[model samples]
Target: MPGSTDERRAAGYRPLLFSIAYGMTGSVGDAEDLVQDAFLGLTRARQEGTEIVDPKAYLTTAVTRLGINYLRSARVRRETYVGNWLPEPVVLPTDRPGPAEHAELADSLSMAFLVLLEALSPVERAVFMLREVFGYGYAEVARATGKTEANCRQIFARARQRVAAGGQMIAFRSSPPERRAEGEQLARRFFAAAAGGDMNALLGMLAPNVALHVDTGGKAQAFGKPLAGRLPVVRLLLGVFRRAGILGVCLRPAWVNGRPGAVKFDADGSVTGVIELDITDGMVQAIHSVANPDKLAHIRLNPNEA
Candidate 1:
């Protein structure tokens, strides 16, 4: 019974651990690896007759430490990235499927918030995600990161302040049906405008200060820097549409990290890239496009669903 109980507990906490890892690293692949490594550590401990007083706490700490280390090393690669480094987009299930389906949790999982998390140091990111996003206490966060409670409190305070300074605060909650429908409509219009190369229509829908972040990872063709201002962004989009017209690729709306976005597909129906827009005040504020082939392996585009 005790063994079964331990197994159940491990299984129950896995999603939570995965959320924490993904929150810190912003890569589903990295998060999965970190979570698996943590569980493997737990199994090794059990085999060596080590008793874990609180398996959840132990596992959380393991995952956090692993995430911190991974981030530290991954920073070098990110620095060398070809262009703007956007977080890997992950699909969120529509229906409430598990304990991870809380509205606040949904908010934190957005690509925007994950991009902000990049501003924090590895330890600070872990502390902020554990304490603020996941609702862990100072004591728990401290244990997870091997920091004193006072140090963790300071780290979280600093991290929160840095995130707040990143323009506007994102409301981390699931959109109601009506609001979601509105956003979907806006996304559809924007997609159509881009597809038709209607620069004026796209300009009307874009906020004056709209910026575009594109990640090509040196594997695809993209701008070397983030494109800012409406004119520049519109010109870039028009050029892209013209090129897509020649190449026989088309844009179809899809959900990118729970937000309405478009995916690019070649004539053979293989995905070329995914684009996500951040909307505010009925206008597009920011656009994030990820064209890195390695980062898109987790997403399977349904050719028929559009």
Candidate 2:
């Protein structure tokens, strides 16, 4: 019975540790691997009778250290990566996430939010996550992250300033019923035009300063960098779709990360990518094309709707 309870405690560490590494790395795959590694380390400690009175804190520290190391070595790590990059967006059960879980999931994992976090150093990121998301005090964050209270406070202040500059909200709950329906119709029209290779039709709906981001992860060719301006993005998308000549790529409108999104599906029904749209004033402001197959595992689509 004691052993079973210990195992359950060890298992519970995953969500907490994943929240840590995923908050820093923003890559679900890497976050899961980090949690697994942290648990393995814990397992070893338990075997050796090191005794974990607070497994969550212990694993959070371990995962944060791993993320710190990853950030320190990110340039080298990206050298051999598959392609152009972005973090894998996490999707949590929002309707029932409640206040605690919603706050936990929201502050810990949104793509736009995490991008702001990327601006911080690994230790700073750890400090920010602990202090802001986990509700830890400066003293506790300092202890957890192995920093002095003063340094942790400074880091937290800096992070707060940067995050404020980003002008992002704490939560982006999916559009309400009526608004969502309207948005879905708009998404459907735009997606159909793009998928059908209608450059003019697609461009008509885009804002003059629309931006597009393609994440091929180096596996497939994509825009080497972010493409800005509506004309340029329209041209780029037109060129790619025209060149590929693949037919029947359908996008089903869905809510991912509490925003308007669509999943790309091939004729044979496999998910090829997820395209998340950010809109302002009825025009597409930003387009996030998530093409890393490894990352889209959490997204689901219905063929009947497609």
- Measured by TM-score, the strongest candidate is 1
For candidate 1, write residues 9-76 as lDDT tens digits.
Answer: 78788778887888888887888888899989998998888888898999999999999999999998
Best by lDDT: 1
lDDT scores for all predictions? 0.81, 0.69
- Model 2 lDDT tens row, 152-253: 888989887877776654433344577655655677788778767788888888888777877777756676778889788887877665654567666666
RMSD of each: 2.9, 4.7
lDDT of 2: 0.69
C-alpha displacement of 183 in model 2, angstroms?
Answer: 5.9
Question: What is candidate 1's CA lDDT for residue 226?
Answer: 81
Off-target runs (Cα >4 Å) in candidate 1 are 92-106
Supply the global lDDT for candidate 1.
0.81
